[model samples]
Target chain A: MTALPASTPRKMGLVIDLDTCVGCHACVTACKGWNTENYGAPLSDTDAYGADPVGTFLNRVHSYEVTPAEGTPFTVHFPKSCLHCEDAPCVTVCPTGASYKRAEDGIVLVNEDHCIGCGLCAWACPYGARELDAVAGVMKKCTLCVDRIYNETLPEVDRLPACVRTCPAGARHFGDLADPGSAVSRLVAERGGMDLMPEQGTRPVNKYLPPRPRDALTATPAATPADPSTEGLGGFLGWIDRTLARF
Target chain B: MHPAPSIILFTTISGLGLGLLAFLGIGMIEPTGLAAFLWFTLGYGLTLVGLASSAFHLGHPERALRAFTQWRTSWLSREAVLAAVAMLVLAPHAIGLIFFNRPLTGFGIIGGLLALQTVLATSMIYGQLRTVPRWNHWTTPTLFLISAITGGALLSGLPFLSQMLLAWLAVAMVLHWILGDSRFAASGSTLGSATGLGARGAVRQLEPPHTGTNYLLREMAYVVARRHVVPLRLIALLAACVLPSVLLWIAPFSLPAIAAAILLHILGMLTARWLFFAQAEHVVGLYYGVR
Candidate 1:
């Protein structure tokens, strides 16, 4: 079961734009909120109210400062979750048949009941996609809001992953990346979306839209120094009077 | 990359147990009466105990049997299956040695090979992980197998074989630290590459997403200071490898000398194995800015 399918019917994934992300933890919270309730078991925290607190979360927004060669360095917010890789090491490295990718939708998930909590999947993950529920001692990750997306009772617009729905900046996009004409696919092509570590060879399904390029660095403009004879307020007043007298 | 105590003990104890089994299978040390009873009890007893210790590492000890299901892909599963097979096959071999006066050549051949194979499979569990570039090396397995063999040789009380294996152990450890350990800094991965920002000159974590230590940081972002690596390497080499060889040279004269050598080597390997897990740089550490 750990051997990946030859191909999935659809490569369902998220595409994120780095340019507009505000580093708000909205998506992170939304993901935690939804998955904690809807998933088979709650993503638990060990010491929630104590001085040292740890909770399992499916997604996180990392803030990175990128210093370019020429321009002033800028900070970029990166919201990271499971990429649902085509060749997910997590799926292959699991001792139990607990962790798996759906052949129908290409969404990777963990069957908690079968998980022995060996944590090998965590070791295999390059992106840190999986987190252990300290309370349940089982692996948990982003299910791409599988429950809501497929729920017929929910409104179509509201049925996306919790992270995608709750993003105030609309930086997150969801669609079938395998489909050339899907909005997410078009976004990937137009913006030159990239894989986080293409060399790691997870062949991640999620694509990241690179930050839009800006004009090369230009020197900061300096204010022209005042002439010695006409620098003060009286000089300006005299110039103003001369103009009035001429009128 | 954090070396959990349970795992450290499991690998160390289990390696020692399996190595003893390997030596016994090869008919290197011929024991009689009480010594034979001691050897078998120690061999199978330590093996089982070490394996039992690993169950403590699981979140649900009751669900540990489910780990046996996946051998096609997982190295962990393969390790379990191979370990089980080695134990099962060796159990009867132990019975034959204890009950019958004659050795079963067939059981010895198969059991010895399987015992060594189990240790090799255990090494592969960490070696195959691409996430930790420090561990994904040939030296990792070589170091593990050599350490096991050296331990086995020493405990089996073969003074000559112990000396030779001690030398081999030193070579493996040196090659492992020199080639394998050094490759981490030289690896092409950078914070930029980790975050898809390689086009930028430099990238650093200004602020972590969460204030508290998450599972990723707790589990993978373990950091060892650069200054400590050398001294520890020396301790591991001198105490674990060379000291054993020198002690084994005098072991023929004094039993205490051989015992000292085994103790020193085990201590040394414990240090080295601790370093093995502690220093492993998981690519996920880049997310936490520990790499």
Candidate 2:
């Protein structure tokens, strides 16, 4: 086995563009597929097409509609998963070392063999990322597709991740954020991205670019023209409109 | 969060063990059923041994003696100490019941005190976790009391009293779930409070400290799907409370029914316990980027 490089103090991560995301759920499906196939254990569903079906998934999309006082209708779809925090409370709380963050890539992975199926890691996460695999009796989560990204056999263009590769909207981006010149780093820098639930202080690696003005997509409504024949009626209606507006 | 099976078993078994012992002590004054006494003592002994076996899950089993040091603050310590005391009192009381054929006046009182201590200590285990808003409540103590009393009554094999206890347990479960859900909702909002800032504080996450998963996420950041929670909660209530109550009522004095009630209670308790931890919103949750 090729040994990983020496531990470095600095950690790298992803920056997601929430504004561009279309809530396709492709990322969620991609993550599930990749992890189930390659992770330490398979993510099993009791009944895929039957009643009372349950399984493990690391990524999920939450769609919300936000109406600002001055803006048109806006819909925000936030695809949330693990933030891969630096001061991960989930790590320290584990009684066993089965749950640990890599000193190299900073990837948090569960040693399936060592896991006692104590669901403490799930409790520590604020993002609701981790889920228990009832069949395997271990915890499962987003690996950022660790196995796929580093495989030398894959072509360079296809080496990113299932989520990033399959994002039809191109909302998700993955790279070494430590390099300021990287695409993710530059996008975060120029777009003035915001982190979700920043107050939690877990220091989520992912960033969300806020939705831009809808004026870019659609033309603003022009002022209505006064009908010359209805001038008298318009005057009366304008007075009523002003009065109603006050209330 | 999926707690280790050992811990789950420990809490459930011990609750049954100590709870039955406490119930027997309460009823001992009335010269009632010898059969009830026999079943209660048997259940208590078995549960105690089961609870003790769970010690193997501890990383430092030999150092379990040190667990008593923090009885002042730690419910775990209090539980250890009280459980030991309960066993001591229970053994002598059992002997008195069998050999002395004497009125268990003094031993009964001692057993009662130990039972009370066990209930309090058991409650404290969850109640003391201030991080878990759902658990850190007065209702937790009430739930503990009800669980012990209900479990004890079921194991006693006394149909009528078991039925009554089962009904009380159903009410207790409902009250606990309602109160617990409300507490969870309240703490969910306090995700903002975790940053130690007031609700208006503008603290926002800019970047996560690490790239990959860590121990904290593995231990605390677990979530069950929202869709599953409601159904599971109802199922837990049915198994833990409703079914047991119905069984107790229909077959008030049946040993099979009583045994079924005990088994159902264990299942229900386990589900409730899982939800208890799963629903609990910790201040640490704020750190994990949840609101």
As for candidate 2, its interface RMSD to one decimal place is 11.0
**Which of the numbered candidates is closest to the native, going by highest TM-score?**
1
- Candidate 1, residue A136: Cα displacement in angstroms equals 0.9
Q: Please, what are the lDDT tens digits per residue for candidate 2 over residues B1-291?
A: 435567666777777777677766655333334754565467567667755766765433454565554454345556777877777776655666655554465766687668768777777766755456677688888887887777776766666766677677777777777887777555544533332222223444433433444444545546645448889889888998789888878887677887888788889988877776566655544554652
Tell me the lDDT of model 1 at B5. Answer: 81
Which residue runs of candidate 2 sit more than 4 Å off their true CA positions? A1-8, A49-54, A92-95, A176-186, A189-192, A198-201, A216-247, B1-13, B16-132, B136-291
lDDT string for model 1 (B1-291, tens) is 888888888888888888998888778775655677788787777778878988997988899888888999888888888889887777666677777755666777688778888889889999998888888899989888988888888888888888888888889888877787666666666778778887966898999989899999989888856459889989988899888888777665578988898899889988888888888888888888886
TM-score: model 1 vs. ground truth: 0.94
All candidates: TM-score: 0.94, 0.54
DockQ of each: 0.75, 0.03
- TM-scores of the first chain across all predictions? 0.90, 0.82
